[model samples]
Target: MTHPSTDTATSALPPLIKGPHERRLGVVALVATLGGLLFGYDTGVINGALLPMTQELGLTSITEGVVTSSLLFGAALGAVTIGRLSDAWGRRRTILLLAVLFFVGTINCVSAPSFEVLVIGRVLLGLAVGGASAVVPVFLAELAPYEIRGSLSGRNEVMIVSGQLAAFVVNAIIGNVLGHVDGVWRIMLAVAALPAIALFFGMLRMPESPRWLLSKGRNEDAVRVLSTIRSPERAEAEARDIRATVALEERTTTAGLGEVLRNKWLVRIVVIGIGVAVFQQLTGINSILYYGQVVLAESGFGAQAALIANIAPGIIGVVGAFVALWMMERVNRRTTFITGYALTAICHFLIGFASVSVPTDSAARPYILLILIVAFVGSMQTFLNVATWVLLSEIFPLRIRALGMGISVFCLWVTNALLSLYFPTIIGTFGITGSFFGFAAVNALALVAMIRFLPETRGRTLEAVEEGVTTGAIFTIRSRSRHR
Candidate 1:
């Protein structure tokens, strides 16, 4: 039944194009993931710098929370706006704009003299971070082959952890070496500017998302871009496939917000997307990234040592993401999410237990608490973070991909904002144990929700997954052939 043109197009693909090729895939993913790295650095930089910033800015407990949450609130807004913008402007251009935002935000944060100024800077940075969070994975997913899409898209998560690790290490060094200096936190906050610059300059040379190009009526350009990254044959075939799907979008003018609300299926999918995004953040991962050093200090570690110890969790988070990438090819999305939630919940309980049971003055307290914190990061990054993003990228239909992902990620950032706002108060009142116990309880509930609702989206082509979601034809497939 296949046409000769289809056969020829398929034949032109190189062997690596047909399946997962680590070297080829890794290189491409790494370049695109620099956006994620900058995101991590900007967000994580605050954890170490907050102490100095608070002292210099004369911030109260509430003000501190506000400063931290402002970025997240900005991110929440950015996720929604930029997500739709990426759909209209193309992923690469959207990313380029985000890179510019990062640069401008960094400059603002580094030079800010007042609390209001600092808050403004953080909010701008949050916008860039939020935009990058939504767009990077989608861009990578659009470029990757189906067989390897999970790992390729997950490269952003890996870079995120790596960026966090780098921030922690830099924070420790800067805080220690410049301990005696006035406003030492400025140096720490300023470190983020370099990566933002790099991301902007580097993205100038990157290719546009082939899928986005096709959607925008630039089919020939999409094929040419795909050919460089994919085998010639695979590129042609994918272009044809994308062309086929674009034809469907052409038949429907379903892009309006009102149209999205009117469609039962789109609304259902959007709700699922929002749940996925919010649940991932509600697990309390960012609390640790933003406040781990403070938690460690509460556990009785000295300021200097706690700063160094915080890097351990950052390192573990990155390693866990790499492991997640490996498992992405083998595990179902539902299974991975369930497993992640269970693990983080258990870790939270353990942390809470350690906090309550261990005497504050005991030498063993900080070490034991540190172990629990690392475990929490490990469980989150390995099982939930990468899987959540990958699922978001694949589960929605092409027509509503940007809208759905934006809305979901907006919920995610808002959840993050709420947690960031309340985290210090929770820790201050209940100590580390009570705070973690709270996270554990919330995570347990999230696990049940995921089991009941989250669909397995790994290992399927975007077109196939979109078809499945739109038609309600299939929920889970053990083999690719069944997807067709």
Candidate 2:
């Protein structure tokens, strides 16, 4: 029934870009982001689980801090070590290895009989979390077209906050309905294994990062992998760009910490990365994620009431992430950071004012504090969290991308760990008002840093952006007009 002329014309034309390949890309992103979900759940579960856990484990305040901070300590190490490993072993293989660690770590935590054993399990989980935190964004960034890189890479943060919300919702349900059950906290800790299993299986079918493939001298393989995720024309174009970048790097010295430190431009970028990472933590977002119930209880809510109310911030967190994804596509990264910090600082001041003005026993105090905290979490999720991770993933050149991200995130985890270890003591010594006031001051400084140093990364290819960074054009006033 077909005409020979029609068949020849069709064959001569480029292959029609099908919808299925795009959907496959989405599926790949979703599966890879399950690691983010696990990262959220593992970190946030302890907020509610710790009370029952402490009761069963006979933990003192010091011991409680140990159990809470051990994972963060491990995460710090994991971020650096696993980041370097990813640079060497490839992102897909490292993530597969992390998936295995997630499974083993979850089993260890579920079966832990003593506080020391529990800390060990948490450390293992932290390693997996840290590794995922470092590698997943890079993987997603590499896989995405530069046009949608922010949204694609930022999805990992959404999954992270969603995972946290999942933990909060699960903890509330379990704690309320099964509060009297023996070792109920174990049930909470065990839930992480489900996602771990899903991540392992899902990654088995996923392709290696094409940029990573190109980095290792596998050009044909890189283009072949890219064809699955991108349109044929775009895939070829991207592969050519990546190969050119890799070739340039090969002609120079190898990318590493030593090279990063030796170059002033690279060091400046690394410093900015470190500042972004640290300021994100210094916003005290994790303090809320890890200790929301405690803050609520101190605000005058009963333990049960605090457990239920903690879900409010978690819900807002997920909503804020949605907003962030929208904004990442439309707004400059610098604008997002400034706006987020400004809002969070305002929320902190209001929280402090509400806590100080309202009587400790006043019924209105808890609700007021809760509203402000929700606003703070929303602001943080919207402007800061997703943007920070996305920028960290994008800012560095390919040569030092993994190691730079690792070192920066290593500082982030360390800051988070120190805060987790001391947050309880801080609340005890300063009360909610003084503690929030301190956070306000820190966020004020963060706002200044954002305005002065952070560069816009939207609407540029990874290779183009890296060229700007290496040339220090990104730091100049003229480069703004070019990117704009």
Candidate 3:
């Protein structure tokens, strides 16, 4: 029989308690988020590392594209493949495996004597990065108390951007201090292994996902694990809710591939999740980061000055992510997403309108666009990026959470990779005006799609989320039930 008190159990979580229990959960999230740090570092390091690497490796344009893009394509592969692996093997074990991959990949890149070897090493690291991207937030979400789950899981996004900022700073300092050193890029590659080492050792002491355990019928183990993170009273209550939900899923949810196609809710939620993931990229944020220098140069800045100015967005990105984290605790996620997408769309339109309206020779044109680009970056990091990841982590039912996240993120990467490959050609053919106009259109459509399909996820337990999402009840405000 269900305990009457169990219904109010989730509400028992005190927001921002700052107690020992909160500290313990915070530590676990930090340890796991090292994967995110590695993700950011590995991706961003290439921005600076590529120049020196090409000088030493004798890379042609085609090969250079290959080297720069190998990780992205590899990340797409890793997100899908490792995502399934986590579902079966478990989130913690999969992350530990990712740690090993990160270490091996870093060493391989640092030691590679040829372009082929370096590309191979980059692909290996991409797998780890993609794996971490999929699993870390999910791991944190499962362990977090509902009251602070948004802030807690959001730490991964903060770490990712922070890691990117760290890479930019590290690359700048190392390249300057040892500007003449041979193979300095190798030293840059070597820095990632330290965090990988930390992630591996840190996760060793962490507990498995209690929700995963509950789904697997390890009831006592689930409650025991929860006890460490939650007060004993709340742990028992949350476990009961999870147990009941899992049992219901076992009985009613049988959507294999063919069945999934037949099942409207299954198909709808998966499709919605994929769209949500892809929409984040369609905002043209990654396209901007990838080609910020090109945009700056077109604005008439000198190469070195453009290079330095580009860091402004990266710095603002980090600041915005922290703001997003603090806001995550206070704001509803749907509100944040719609607000962000709307803001970015407006910024993109203004950029397009300005690019055409203002004379290219005008001195103020560059500064005007620069401010707009920074605002666009700020809006994205502050609202869309972190929320997208956090939403991806928690939106699916437990049965298909990793798989849903994997496929969605795979599409997200594929979209990002596509933009990266073709963005230069886009600007070449249509110039900045046409390209950003296209971006504005895409974001506008995305905003509508989201408002129509996106569900409110704030202040819900994983079990509550699973119930609402799978049944299609979450999309309708009044239809959604509050767990508390």
Candidate 4:
């Protein structure tokens, strides 16, 4: 059976009995996205906390690196492991498990008295962060209607950045006001627990992914869940389409690691997924997020000024994400990716030039570099970051969606882990000029790869995209002239 077009399905379905369903969906999306918020705060809090933490714990530079990267290491494992677990157990259950882990991990970080114990805590938090990153967007996508999936799934990224911004603001306040207090860093670490608690409580009322239920041969339950989020007519139509796609796949061998490797088209798409995941990090975005204060200080700002300056990028990041949400509905994903890279690569070049051309002692040098950095962050948020996560959530076939996403994001977290571990050394060895110049080169290559390989998924249903993937028609599908 052929998949029905979303428009035709919606048209044939009854007029949406709007009120309670939309509100419920909105609430579910909000509660589910709390995972994104915790993911942000836990990862970003360390930026400012690490300095005071070092003094309190008597940490060496090596130990500090270990503490910072340990979370990333844990996240890589979480992305893959939790992804597979979500596939087996279900998305809602996996996320609920992550919520409990977030609470426990935050408590560990807040109470730890030694560096070794703190690293252990960070590893736990990392696992939660990684799991959320891998699962939350897909959860939202699976629950959302095809027409609104981009915006709904993309909201998780906005929440992620918002969480990061909240961490920056909180760290700034605590760092400046409580700089003299004993263990001020503990306060920063402890604040994350609030969201963890919120996530756990919020998820209790949320629904499981309907697509997942359908996958498990529970069609009635899938329709029931879908009805809560969709109009009655739309719900039944979507259920029919999903069942058709699942039945088609069941006629063939199951998709797995072996199947992905043996099928040339599947391998091609998986490689594309990995490439986007890697290039997203290679843009040098996280290095800035994880170490913005350090980068600013190196640009010649005083310690206090550098801490305050870090908040600028965070502000612009949120603003840019709003722009991205607006654009995701109108623009093609491939176009957005290419535009983001071009803008960021140019910003990277200007940052390098400003660092070298302006004398270190000049009053304007740091401010100039700060503006360029903010521009880069804004460009990245507007195009690359949100679009990348949304595409990852939508691109894979239903059979291996979770596993494929886990593997792709696993590579992303690994790249992020390596950079978080060695970013300081890169700066120490090459200085700002060399480091940003390298980012420029990497982004240039990224732009080319996006143009050649990235398929546009702006207005298609997840099932429709899966059909294209299975038939190898995605690569040949031209960009839609007008977004629906």
Candidate 5:
């Protein structure tokens, strides 16, 4: 049986028949996404701090890569291990554990006495970042009404970029003021503790996912949880809907990794999911964040100018995310992905050409490249970055949503880690012209993949999307049948 499109599901959200449910859901979503905020701040803060960090830590090029990528590598492990663990333990509880990891990780980084110690601390933070990426969206998606799922899940991306912008602003102030102080980067690193504490404490007031409760055979508890977030009448109805979907999956085969693999269509969609994640990172976006200042400096901006110019991209990223929030619910996912990749590819080429074609000695060259860099940031933020996250959150089957997203993001971070590791060297060898041309090439390929293979996911219910994904039916967008 074919399901209605997401627009139909969204239009069908049980009217705000219950006041308390909506309020509670909003509160819980905000509280849970604190993890996202911390995720953004911790990662973005490093951008401004890396210079002082390198000087104080006495880092070589190899060590610089290690210090930067240790967190990403840790995040890869966190995304995979915690994703599976959350599948069993429960999303809310897993998030709490992640909060603890974030706190400990931040503390370790703040007090590290040596470069090796800092890398360990960063790795710890990576674990928290990875866990947050997987669990928070799962929690949000499970709790949200179908009509608002796009908007609600999209909020996490907003918070993540907001956190990054906050970090960049804070880093600029601290670096400028304490620019002369020893170990000032530690202060920047330590500030992450505030949000970690907030996320941990905030989770105390939140409800366990109603869908998770249903999956574990606690139907009444699911109702209760749903009641806290939806009207009583709608809560009961949604509880039944959720239970039926879970039952369907269970009857098909016990929902597990094995079942997912046994189904050929499920396997195909999973490959697409993994591809989406990898391509998002392969554009070298985070690599820019990880080493933007270095790249900017190499482009002829002085050290202070490079440090300050880094803030421009962070700002653009935040703005682009808000634009994405608006677009996700309105535009076709495939269209947005194609447009985003294509635009970014153009910017990459322009930046590369500007880096080489524009003479370094010419006063306008650095400025032109800077404008191109900002354009690249805008293109990504406005289209690809948040859309990728939104699609990943929405596309997976309920049984493997967290796992699929986790595995996908794991690849993303790993790709990010490798890029972070080798990016400096790549830049060292080919210069900005060569480095950006490589990204352009990757993005050009991604444009084809998106146009040819990616499916539209804008307004479908999770159950509907799951059936489509698991059955390899996404390619066959038949009109909805009256199955229910």
Candidate 6:
């Protein structure tokens, strides 16, 4: 029942305690991540479901690519547009809207009697996924105390991987139990609606992001929300910081996207954000997520085995994310990015090398390739995926945070869409070896990009990061709140 007295509230706050406040924050993060769960299940379900879908719809390779890539293209658009909408409409409201979209999209997908309707449904779901990608991490970052922001924002990422794991398991069970059964894919697709429903109802009870409230000049509301997840002294101090940052930021008020582009520092950060997004996608992770079954079958596994084998990466991905949550609190952001790229690039090359070196009928290529792919996914979840989203959430100023994330993820999905669109063809022409070799080359370039362009945002408050980036002090590799 202790309250932060007026005197201490104006002074520095004490360190955080691990108790009710942390539990409440954890609850909020979990609820918000229901959106992320939908994101993963909707995206990853297609990997196992596509074959059955193709059988029923009589899809050609070209149409299969279209059906798969259409959602990614829609995600690109959704990332940009719905993200912008969140800035205007508020984070909670936008997420609620996305939830409804997820449910409707799932229903559309489940009931689609033809390929065209299914693609339309996939596009609709993509909007929800893309919007969540843009907004959920931001919401978590804003709600969390700066000291633990990395791990808290990272929860959404864990949920994303968990959802993918759920999808893989569900598909394995359904596809195996009802092998080639009519509309088996629809059962897999329909599982997504449950989380969408949870997200809609769960978000209803969550508070608006305090930072967003502060941006709207609702300081009292901001502090109230913060207090629920932080100590009163911490909440008040945090609210004060947010309010000052909001007041100081120009682009958020009078300036628009055009104005932000004109500012070189903002533009630099935005460009870097976009490049990071592209890098994460180009690691060829989604190639495995969306088309793993195809890759495995070609590598020599039977359809049933590939379906089961795909679950391995899903399991490792979730495990890696849990590891990442721990690392996010302890490691430097730039270090993880560099290490992730180096490790993933090496794994990519090994997969390519092993794919070609081993005989096609050796009966070992599938297992070898599977191990390498799982390692690549592990390296990614442990280093890149969580760090990528955390950096995007924290790198930009509050004024342009939404824009930076939206545009960056837009580019990410665009790259993903292109890769998805052409990957079947890539596999057709060049096979697994060539496609992965190409991924290796891309990761090499991405590693260089990370070393040079990525900055350390760990131990920095959002306001501190903004000041460092805008004032060009970021080059000094220091922050205003490093001690915190």
lDDT agreement with native, every candidate: 0.84, 0.90, 0.84, 0.90, 0.83, 0.87
Tens digit of lDDT per residue, candidate 6, span 1-484?
1222223332445678776878888888999999999999999999988988999999998899999998999899999999989889899999999999999999999999999999999999988889999999888888877678899999999999999999999999998898757899999999999989998999899999999999888888888888888888778777776776777774344336886777788888899899999999999989889998888888899988888998999999999999999999898888889999999999999999999899988977889888998999999999999999998999888878888889999999999999989888899999888988999999999999887777778876777777777776675563422333
User: Candidate 3's residue-wise lDDT over 239-281, tens digit each?
Assistant: 8778877778787775255656777877888898899899998
Please give the lDDT score for candidate 6. 0.87
Q: Which prediction has more favorable lDDT, 2 or 5?
A: 2
240-309: candidate 1 lDDT, tens digit per residue:
8777767776675476679778867677778989998988988888988998888889989988888898
Alpha carbon lDDT at 220, candidate 5: 86
Q: What is the lDDT of candidate 2?
A: 0.90
Candidate 4 residue lDDT tens string, 1-484: 6655534544544554677889899999999999999988888999999999999999999999999999999999999999888988999989999999999999998999898899899999999999998999999999987767898999999999999999999999999899999999999889988888888888887889999999999998999999898878778878887888888878863757998888888888888899999999999999989999999999999999898899999999999998999988888888899899999999999999999999999999999999899999999999999999999999998988888899999999999999989999999999999999999999999999998888877777888888778778877765442243
Instruction: Specify the highest-TM-score model's number.
Output: 4
Q: TM-score of predicted model 3?
A: 0.93
> If both were scored by lDDT, which would come out higher, candidate 3 or candidate 6?
6
> Where does candidate 4 stray beyond 4 Å?
2-17, 479-484
Q: Could you tell me the lDDT of residue 36 within candidate 5?
A: 89
Q: Which ranges in model 3 have alpha carbons more than 4 Å from their true place?
A: 1-18, 254-256, 478-484
After TM-score superposition, what is the CA distance of residue 152 in candidate 5 from its true location, in Å? 1.0
Model 2 TM-score relative to the real fold: 0.95
Clashing pairs in 5: 6-459, 6-460, 21-229, 21-230
Deviation (Å) of 124 in candidate 6: 0.5
Model 5 residue 387 CA deviation (Å) reads 1.2
- Identify the runs in model 5 with alpha carbons over 4 angstroms from their true place: 1-13, 16-18, 478-484
Higher-ranked by lDDT: 3 or 5? 3
> What local lDDT score does residue 340 receive in model 1, on the 0 to 100 scale?
93
**For candidate 4, what is the TM-score?**
0.97
Which consecutive 10 residues in model 4 have the weakest lDDT in total? 5-14
Per-residue alpha-carbon lDDT of candidate 5 for residues 29-126, written as tens digits (9 for 90 to 100): 89998998988988888788887888987888788778888999999999988988888999999999999999999999999989888888999999
Q: Flag regions of model 2 displaced more than 4 Å.
A: 1-18, 478-483
